[model samples]
Target: MLVTTPHQDHSATDLPRTGPATEPAAELALLRGDFEVHLTVGAEAADALAAWAEEHGVKFVHILLARGSAASQPMLTLRASGSYTEVLAETRRTARRLAADGFTVLRAKVESVPWAEGVPASDADAARFGAARYFEHHVKLLVPEGAATDGLAELAVRHAAHLSRNARRVRPDGVREQFVTQRCRLVGSETAAARLDALLADLTAAGHQVASAEREFVALDSDETLDAGWIDEVAAVAKVAAVSTAA
Candidate 1:
């Protein structure tokens, strides 16, 4: 990704929007095996994200809430096999497709959950690769030479529990497997969002380049009641970030 230069202002298409025009989300992924993928492009891309999830069995909070953009082409059929080998191949294909789709590709990778090299020896062994949905909440920046470590450290410490799916999967009837934390992102509350925004603005004033700093509300895919859990998680996300920044 181009770090030194400021990110382009990704203009939204005529598609319905869930938030401010300045904030738009685009996503593409395959949720099978260890081939999980999640990414957000321009706000215009949310059009595709919304339509594709409903068409396929995808789980996404942003798409469910989004309303403005027009109809968009779906990227991939979500009806993929759970086999590790099959999904791995599909994930590679998915990444290639994304690269050719005009979006900038950064560190495209396919990894095994338990860190195995070759295919599993038995059906049971392969199950350890457990299916998961991939997503991340990040604030990319180009700080001073020495500041990179601190920035990365802060991200490592705080962004893990910040955002959740950027994903919307259509599950089969009556399937109720609880969605665990594959990972998380963004400030949770308006106050935290404003504070983080202020910090980024201050960084700009001090000559630091912020490539992207987005705020994501709390999200989870589960059958249980989680209203309180959501609030606590969001608050925890905000607190960790603030503490990390202060340190």
Candidate 2:
């Protein structure tokens, strides 16, 4: 016989970040691209969910009774890390398996955090560095309005040799599956923010009608963990650039 309990209403003030006591070590070690799997189950099936996780080698990072619009429901959030492809595949398989086991699977969502080598001094620093690295290393260029694309392309070509000289290839874990190709994709734009600044400056100097610049972020790769905080310091300047562009 299957046993189930009615959904209860949890007071808004009673909800904790991770429910019960917090686990500092596990929370701190979480990296970008780590999977956040949310599973909703019947109120009385918490034990069954725990058993299923144990049998499947999945670790439950947090379990909480979340208040829904109408009622409170038991929710499980788990953390899993691996290559993008691997994590996605495993999440799908787990959801399918759970549904087949006579449990009501409400929803499963995956959220990715940017990877950092070590914990930031604070959350503010993390956001600063995260934005910087995103713009500098991940982004290729920011071409402002009416900027000479031909001139920029020519500049990139001319600086290709010099940029290649300073380029550094990152191959973490001795695996070629993920690597960063850091090359001189542009001249004058040595840093992430500098690239945008230079592009806008050049256009203004040349008397071009500059309204704003176009932006492009780097493509996603399997090696996000490599050099996770490489551009934190440089990104400080980028933070300013982002604001300036928006203004």
Candidate 3:
């Protein structure tokens, strides 16, 4: 369940004169919303963390390799998701377990804002929202630094054609074409998960090194409900894709 700190009573004169009232409005309600908990773990612990999430059926937004950190150890950002309460609980549990195992875990809370109230009141709000939804499951097929780009153009053409059969650009009328020219493509959650095998096979066969992929969900609308199943599918695919890249 979502919990909020109780607001203290204040006189009207004590409220700000230049802005909205300080008092919590009755119309302002808290809803059980989705959120992600971020934690940094060393490279030695990355595989373990990923395995734990898979074993426990936890969903993850992304896992990023932290660069230029002061620590000698390679660091990674392990992001886990759930409702506010669940994320807090899971983060604490995972932190405790990993710490006991001698892994350094630094945790941070990434809270979700109320969609409607958070957006700026402007004419571009609709465009902003549309872009958000379309790129909700955006994944990047990264090429390793210093890797050969010799065949990249031809490979991208072939890959784009393959993706066209399964993906559609967020804005079909937009100037940029997916797969063909743009490396980033918008795909359905299920489609992305289902295409992992083919994607891996194609990229590897083309002498392309897929170093890593990032995944995240951007809400289409303020009130959009997250699909736990879709999140799980993404999490699973991400894990497999990461392993494939390492191999």
Candidate 4:
């Protein structure tokens, strides 16, 4: 993946400067590409949906189902592949089964399909395929604000501490087959560079190689060959990375 440098300051007319720009930038990134599935359920419905998805080979990146306002009511939000036609077919199958079993289909909506950053529809196919490999699963963890005045410095200290203690025990929550792990790395924005440097220093102290560094991201390597342990460590690193990057 091509690492992006810290953005140049925006002109006064271009964007508001009352707060941090990164928040809005992240929001826009989310808007650029996403797919959503909406469904409502009664008791035992979520289990049925999971079973149906498994039986039909319907893979998704994230599947979130929550209890609604009343007892025995549930709602699901699923994000999956970008292919609309194929996804619709899968949804239909699920709906048919649910309907036959006397469940209610509240609303089915296909939100935005994933699209290339700057590619026009005419060239979307080639652009999508070329850019698809760059997609990585990012998990963000919030840094708590304590009684310290220097939030950034405190963030660094806590991050380094977390890495030392817990950067190797986080296990994946059964999403492994749907999402693949690639070259796991640490990353930060310019605002968080000092904290990043501190964390990277801790990583090096632990004997992991600093594989690469650019303004947007940093890469780290394990002494042992990459395996499930590395995957767990990456999850731990992700927690630290997220807190550091969070404003």
User: lDDT for model 3, on a 0 to 1 scale?
Assistant: 0.36
What would the per-residue lDDT of candidate 4 be over residues 91-169, giving only the tens digit for each residue? 4445444555666654343333324232122333223323111122212222222322243223333442211111212
TM-score of each: 0.25, 0.30, 0.30, 0.27
Question: lDDT of candidate 4 vs native?
Answer: 0.33
Number of the top-ranking candidate, with lDDT as the measure: 2
Which parts of model 2 have CA positions greater than 4 angstroms off? 1-32, 61-67, 83-85, 116-247
Cα-based lDDT for every prediction: 0.33, 0.36, 0.36, 0.33
Worst 10 residues of 3 by lDDT: 221-230
lDDT of 2 by residue, 1-247 (tens): 0121233332222112222221212332332344445555555666787677676666432222111231223445556654333443454455555666766654444334433223233444345323222322211232343433455333322211101110122344332211111221221122434555554454456544443332322212212222232212334345545778999
Query: Could you tell me how far off, in angstroms, the CA of residue 233 lies in candidate 4 after the best superposition?
Result: 36
Candidate 2 — what's its lDDT?
0.36
Per-residue C-alpha lDDT of model 1 across residues 60-165, encoded as one tens digit per residue: 2332111113112122323233443344334444434444555432222232232223333333432332222122223444433323244333333333321122
Query: Which 10-residue span in candidate 2 carries the lowest summed lDDT?
Result: 159-168
Model 3 TM-score, 2 decimals: 0.30
lDDT by residue (138-244, candidate 3, tens digit) is: 22444443443446444433432211111222334333222211111244334433444445566678665454433333331221121111122344346556877
